[model samples]
Structure formats: structure tokens, C-alpha cells
Target chain A: MSAALDAAPGRELPVLAVVGVGLIGGSFAAALRRAGKVGKVIGAGRSRDALVRAKGLGLIDEAVALEDAARQADIIVLATPVGAIPAILSRLLPFLKPDALLTDVGSTKADVVKAARSALGDRSECFVPGHPIAGAEKTGPEAASADLFVGRTVVLTPLEENTEQCRTLAIDLWKACGARVVLMEPDAHDAALASVSHVPHFLASVFMAQVSGADDADLRLSLAGSGFRDFTRISAGSAEMWQDIFMANRDAVLQELKAFRALLEQTESALAQGDARELHELLERAAVARRFWGSRSGHE
Target chain B: MSAALDAAPGRELPVLAVVGVGLIGGSFAAALRRAGKVGKVIGAGRSRDALVRAKGLGLIDEAVALEDAARQADIIVLATPVGAIPAILSRLLPFLKPDALLTDVGSTKADVVKAARSALGDRSECFVPGHPIAGAEKTGPEAASADLFVGRTVVLTPLEENTEQCRTLAIDLWKACGARVVLMEPDAHDAALASVSHVPHFLASVFMAQVSGADDADLRLSLAGSGFRDFTRISAGSAEMWQDIFMANRDAVLQELKAFRALLEQTESALAQGDARELHELLERAAVARRFWGSRSGHE
Candidate 1:
């Protein structure tokens, strides 16, 4: 029945195969199944334990080995770490069919796009690189849920070599998952995300490190509340993942760091003068700017 | 009626005069009134309009001029900007009765303590400086609600010279308002909050400035979601208030900013080298530390 249907249509919901069934991958499986967009969803990973659990939990329809899963599937979703993307693509490249749509959900895009293009032979054009700008520090398959993408932005960084069908299919899949999709070239996307995403992680970490080094660290911790907790929350996420993001987008991150340093100097000078009004004015600008922006965003 | 009952010893609930009928001040008044702890809640502020409205909304039993309110009330709460504390206290000093409990809901305790010492004639010992870590970005009397302090912390900074009754009475008032009272010294509270609260605002503002400066600021604003918005939420607070906070705790703010810069450099170098293990290891520490500290403070 499926074979005849596939032969008849323009795009019969492709057999969606997911590799690395962690948070992003598991979420992808759940979203696909819940939306009823894909014909069938398959899970592939090195962990047989995870695969059995994934199938049992109905996170995917069937569990298959990685290489076999890639060869048989019509669309491949790689939701592994940025560092792991190259190796995962390399392993699956020799087996991928021509029409298969290959994509990823890594935070950064340029490096992943390069790796996918090089590893997938002519199927590079079939590759659609993506980043779901949605997360929590909490990870693993147990944390996966179907409605995670609601009201989140899923950014797609399609390369020069990416085919029109690749971009369209990826957009349709994310839209079905209840995400707002935005497109950019891989390099531009990587640059913007480094400033918006990766830099924030490092800044929060440094703030934590300062407090940890304090003589009254224990006291401050007890006194810390929602504002401080929210500010430092992401500092608790995967260090390795953060490191990859920082390294991947070093130039942009450094540029942002410099800007923060200058602001600090100006604030320090203001304090030294005991010029309360002048200091207040500077902080007022920052405060007003943030408040105004939040108002404009409709969330305040 | 209130004075006649108050003169009869423990028969009358002490009156609390909140000096500003904005969100925090109004909420504090409402909470005290709701709990039935105070015999009378009077408001004293420059905004006759807000005071009249606060009375209409039943936030206060009376809206009197600052001096008139100070002459009658047993407690005076300076619930305004840190910069205005000195001037506000100077005006209220002549009207305050002998042994009246003077306190504030200022964010910075050190500055307030200094201002109180300089402003009050003899009963500086009656002054108990405090910060109730309960408020919303929403301001004015209209946004005031009684439940704003239900589960938040109220940190009191009692100087060594401050009387025990002053401390006890302050804590009692906060407890009546349903706040968890945390006691600390003025300098320590200022320094500690500088690390936890003031520094986070600077980090967010500096980071946001770059993004807001971008040619596509509007586009970025639209694409941002709950997490990004949540993380940067406090940046939208009153600039005048934040300016005072940052300026008052300038040294601590600068030190924290420097530490962040160094940490970013380290993270940048690590990312440039693609050191996923080292990066992840650091981030893992930050996540665990933040969770442990943040959760304890009721921030998570």
C-alpha cells in the first residue's frame, strides 16, 4: 500500500529517520508523530537501550541501526552535538540514497553546513541544515515532549548548494511541529546566533564564576532570587556543547565581549566621580533601552 | 481614633506610612491591610494623583502630605529610588515623631544606610534599612496587588547601632506582608546584591545593546521567544532605579564585569580550538552550581 502511494504522489510524507535520540532528536521524533506529517518515523542511534526505550515510549515507530536507518529512510534528521555532526554525516554518507533529505538541528550552522556538504557527495544539495532556537539546560530522551516547539523559532540555514525542495520540506516539517521558521545563509546565521545565543552562555558563566569566588559566596547564594537565578540558569547547561558553540563563532563572541568591557569601564569611571546623576543617566539609558525593547516585543 | 487606641498600649495595630504609592509601595500597603496587621495604612508621595488613585483602589486608608503623614504614622517606608533616599529622608526627618520606626524598601542598603545616618537627627538607631525582593516591571498604583509579596524574600540591613526593636518590628512588618525575612548587614547586602542583581542587569544590557544596535533590531525582536525574553526580562525595569543601583555598587559591578570578560576570553580561546571537552566541563560546573544556588533562593 505504501509503495503504490509513494509511486503516485509528488511528496508522500517521507519516512523520517532520526539519528542520536537525545533531546533534539527525541523531540523531532515526537513532533513528527504527533503532527501526523511523516509516513513513518524511525529512530537510529548507537544506544540499543535508548532505541528500545524510544520505541516503547512511542517516540518513534520502529528502532533501526544507524547505517541501515540512513540507507532506507527518505529524510534524515541528525540531532547530534555540533562536534559529532561531522562523524555522523561521514558514517551515513556512503549509504544515503539520492532523494533523501538530510538535515540537522545543531545550534551553529556554518561548520555543520560545510561538513554536510563535504560528506554527502552529490546529496549535499539534498541537505537542509537547521537550528531550533529552543532549549532548556535539562536534556536526554526522558525530557523530550511533543509540544516543546510551540512558540519557538526554528532557524534554517540553507546553503548555496541546497535544493529548493530541501528548504521547502524542512520548513513544512518545522511548521507542522508548531515552530516559526526563519531562513539565513549558514555563515550569517552562525554569526548572528553566536552573538545572540553562545555569548550569553559565556557571560552568564563568568557572572557565576565571580559569585563563586566571593568570600560571601554562601551568603549571596542564600540571598539570590529569581532575577539572579534566571540570569545564571543557562550557565548550568552542557559545557562541551557551549564550548563548541563559542569556538564555532569565536569572532562574533569576542566582538560582543569587547562591547561589555567598554560599558564596564564607563560605569566604573562614573562611580569614581561620585557623580550620581551622570551614572544614573548611563544606567537609565540601558534600562530604558531594555524596557522599551521588551515593551515592543509584547512580553513585558 | 487610631491615636486614642495606640496610646492604650498593645490595643492598636501600629500605622505604616508607605512614602511612595507605586507598585512596590502600593503592594506593601495592600498586603498589610489585607493581613489586618496595621490599624491604618497611609501613603506619602509627590504624586497626589497616584495617592488619590491608590486611596480609590483601597491601597491606603489615607493619602496625606509627607510631613503630615510622617507626624502621625509609627513607621515610615521610603519606597522610592536609591538616589532620592537622602532628599526624601531630609524632608521627612522634621515631621517624624520621637522613636518612630524609619525604614525603606530601597534596592541598595549601603546607600540608604549612609543617607539615613546623614538625614536623621538622633534616632538613626530607629532606622532599619531593607529591600523586599518583590515587584513587577509594571509600575504605578493601578498594577498594585496584595499578593506580590506572598513568597518572596525581604532582606533587612540593620546596622550594628540599630535597636533590636527596630529590627524585630521591621521583620514583623515584612512577615505580616507574607515575605520571608532575611537579615544581613548593610555593606554585605549591598555587595552581595551587587553580584547577584546589579551585575546581571549590566550583563544583559551590554549584551542586548549590541543586538539592539543591529540593522535588523526589529526582526531580531520578533524572532525572540520566552527563554530569550525571560533571560533578558529585568533589563526592562526602571532605568532611573537601575542607574542608582549600578552607581551605588560601582566597584562590585566593575569587578564582576571584568571577571566576565576574562571568562569570555577563556571560552573564546577554547571554542577557537574546538575544545568541546574543556568547554563542556566548565559549562557542567556552571549548570550544577547555578541549580544548587539558584534553587535554594527560590529562583528556579
Candidate 2:
């Protein structure tokens, strides 16, 4: 570790390394830079051109190899796809400084935790799994913003081996990015997100595919209004990212999907039987709950 | 009909009546008034207090009984729930002038067409079945706007018995409100709407119900980001309105639901089997189509 970085310990600004410098990593770097909480940002990703662009856009102070970044960074953020977590963690473990804190911005928690445990072994104490519940359909560094995490939630799934210092620093990092940090068990986080995030994105994609594959797709698209537009908005997200999420969070997502399908079947039965009272009750329950959430969230 | 309305025939501004002065009806009245396309707007609904409020808000010049409005109005708009179409049509026909024109802003056209044919009989020619594909989750006259239909599509399912003049006038009325009017078969409109609008709303409502019904609903809702907010926005719409729509367009909605469920099963199977390629392909198809639509709609 650098003498300057160790001079004041936790009080000093972080020398951050962001692997996979895409939307999530780039935005984190930008947000911390804007808040004056990051002394320097080192970016590492598969694409050299993207890293150069990120540096040109001032999202990073330097573009370096993953091993070099891990060796020097005070804090390392693995912001790659969930499927890449294990491999990347394995690569960085050999060069990671003993005092350095490690965190990630993958969507699913349990899988990432497992991957970290398998890859880092005893060094897993330095890693805190996280997910920032904020994104746009747009991708890459050019779409990154300094305020992307402002007023958003960042979930941290701290491991049993994680020291208090590691957990506290992880929380502070996200908080400095203008996000509210919450602690959760990795499994619980996965299940809850599967219900709220994963399943919704999956359903939207399935619906979009269904509509677009129809014989009269052009006609249907032409007639679609704002309802369809908003309902399917998340389906425009990166396919590889969603694929990793669905695969990584398979069990929880499947459980939620099963529950959702059961509810849908009930609704279909009500409509098929022309049971107006039952249908109205079902819709009313949903409408009431949605309005309550919208009001509380200030999204109405 | 008034002598002033009859004096100039098609050239004179018509005395308009909105059967249910809620968002759709009130907005139509407000938009027409803003465009100076109507001589006066009469409001009629079950809620006298609401009608009075509409009058106070200047959404209508008068509040009267349905039959009274039917007798005086040169053009009448039935904006009541889909289930009310037949009963309202029956009550209005006794007092409706032979030269007067009638239309409706129901979400489903097939059922409305059937109701109009049964209730209006030969006079169905004067009643053009229309569905303006625009709305907000809010209801009542207070939520109405003078430009709600601007740049929106209004589908007119013209009856076989309707005169060319009736169709033209219906088209002109929507055009004056700054909406683009398109002609469609009643059945075709219902099928297309079920695919794009009705099923999406139903699914959103169903998903909302699922999330709220979960044991950890509060946690899930708290963690939900912009995607969940937008995905469930339409679920907050009026329950009674959607109930009426589902019942009225039961067949088409059920068919679309069946198709959607099938696609969802395919996704589930892929996820269960860990078939990454299949899942990626499905997500990519949806992503491409949704991106194209979003770009075209200027929502991205």
C-alpha cells in the first residue's frame, strides 16, 4: 500500500480500483469523484477501447491491468457481470494488499458470496457483496453519471468473516456516492431482489418477446400506448447482464416466478369465468397496494 | 335539437354531451372546448356532486340527466365503463334525435359494438365505436386536461350501417382534439388492444399483487428501483375500469394471457435447465425489439 494512503487510514480518501468499468463501475467512480471521496480511480476491463474512453471521459484517472490495480488500490470494486465474479476474484486475490477492502456491484448476492468464498478462501474477510438498486437501460461508460446513485439504495451482504472495519468502509463508500446503505444476509438479499427486480425484468423480457414474435407485431406495436412502453422499459436492458442475473439467481427467481404464475392463473380463471366480483377484488388489491407503494416512494 | 345547431347543419358547432365526465370524457370535452369545436358541453354521470364539480371547473357548461342531454346534444360521447354501454344506450335512444350522432370512448370495441347493435338497432349507424388510447392512473373531472389526446391515437371501429358523413364527423372531432384517428374493425381493435394494452395491465396488476402479498413485501418494495416503479405504474389505475375492460374483452385478453404464459414457461424451463444460450437468445430478442420501439417512441 502507498505511504500516503496508509498515513490516515480510513480517514483518507480511497485509491479505488474498478474492474469492468461499465455503467455501474464508471458511475461509482464518477459519483465518488464528484463527492471528493476518491483520491484516484484505476479502471480495468476486457475492452481496452472502453477503458480508454472511460479515461478520456474523466471517469478514471488511470487505466491499468487488473493485477496491477489490485496491488495498488486501497479499495477494489468488482463491477463485472455476476458470471465473471469468481474468475475475477481469483485473479485479483494473489495481488490484493492485506489491508485493502474489496466489494462488488453484482445484482445477485448469494451467488456472488459463494463465488467470493470459493475464490478468495480465507481472504473472503476483505470482500463485501453489494448491489446498487439503480440503473438505466443505457450501458457503458458514456452513459455513466455522477448522481446515478443519489437517493438510491445500496445493499451490502457482509460475510461472517468480514471485519467491522471492512463492513464500515464498504458502507461508507456507497454512502459517499449518495446512496443509502442497508445490511442484509446474502440469501435474503437474493430472495427479495428476485421478487422485486429479477422476476420483473424477466417478465418484461418474456412479454416483449411474445409481442414482437406475433404475426401482427407491427400492428400491435403501432397501437401500443404508454402502458406497454413503461411496462416493457426494462426489457431493453443488456441481455448478457440479465442472463447472468437469471442464471445466478435461478432458485429464488424460479420460486418467485412460480408464485407470479399462480397469481396470473387465478386472474385468468376469474376473467375466463366472467366472475366480475372476483376479478374486481383481485385488481383492487393490486391497485391499492401499488398506489400505496407509489405514494410512499414519491413516485406517484 | 337546437335551431342554432340545425340551422348550419354540419357547419355549425355541435352541442356536446359527455355521459361520464371522468378523465376520458372530461378530457374530450375540455379538448374540444379548447379547440372551439363545440358550442356547449353537457355533463351527465351517476355522481351529482362530481358533475357539479365539473361545472365549477368549467369542464362542462351544464349538468343534466342522461336523457335530457341526449335530447339536446348534436353529438354525444359515452365515456362510462364498458359494462354500462348497453344500459346507457337504451336510456338515451328514447330521447336521442334522429339527426344526432353518437360515439363512445370504451377501451374494448367488440363488446361495445355488440351492445350498440343490440341497443341502438338500426340507429347503430350514428354510433361510431371509438377507443382513444390515452389515459392516466388518475380519475375524475379534476384530473382532466385540455390536451390529453394531443398526438395520441383514437381508434374508430365504424359500423357497417354507418353513413360516410358519420365516420367523417367522428374522424374530424378527434382530429380537432389534436388526436390522430385510425379506422379499425371492432374485433381487430379488441385483439390488438388485448395483446398490447389489456394483457400488460393485467400482468402488471398481477405482479404487483404478488410482490405485496409476499411475506417480505415491505423489504421488496423498499428495494424496488425505477424499473419496478415504472413496471407497476399502470397497476395503480382504477380497478373498476380495468375489471369492466377484462370482462368486456374477456376472450381476447384470455388468449393473449395464454400466449404470454406459454412464453414464460419456455423461459422458466430454460432457467431450470440452466440453458444459458436459450435464455440469452430470449433476452436478446426482447432487448432488440424493446430498444427499437423505445427509440421510435422517443421514450429512450
- TM-score of chain B in each prediction: 0.91, 0.95
RMSD of each: 3.3, 2.4
Off by over 4 Å in 2: A1-12, B1-12
- In model 2, how large is the Cα lDDT of residue A107? 92
TM-score of chain A of 2: 0.95
Clashes of 2: 0
Candidate 1 local Cα displacement, residue B74, angstroms: 1.3
* Residue B36 lDDT in candidate 1: 71
TM-score of A-chain in each prediction? 0.89, 0.95
What TM-score would every model get versus the actual structure?
0.90, 0.95
Per-residue C-alpha lDDT of model 1 across residues A120-219, encoded as one tens digit per residue: 7677887889988776566877778888887678888877777777767778889989998998877777666655666677778767866776777888
Worst 10 residues of 2 chain A by lDDT: A1-10
DockQ of 2: 0.80
lDDT of 2 by residue, A1-300 (tens): 432234354566768899988888999999877877678899997889889999999999999998999888888898888888888888899998887888999999998988899999999998989999888566899989988999889999999999878887788779989998999999999999999999999999999999999999999998899899889999998899999999999999999999999999988988898999988888999999998998898776
Give each model's whole-structure lDDT. 0.76, 0.89
State the TM-score for model 1.
Answer: 0.90
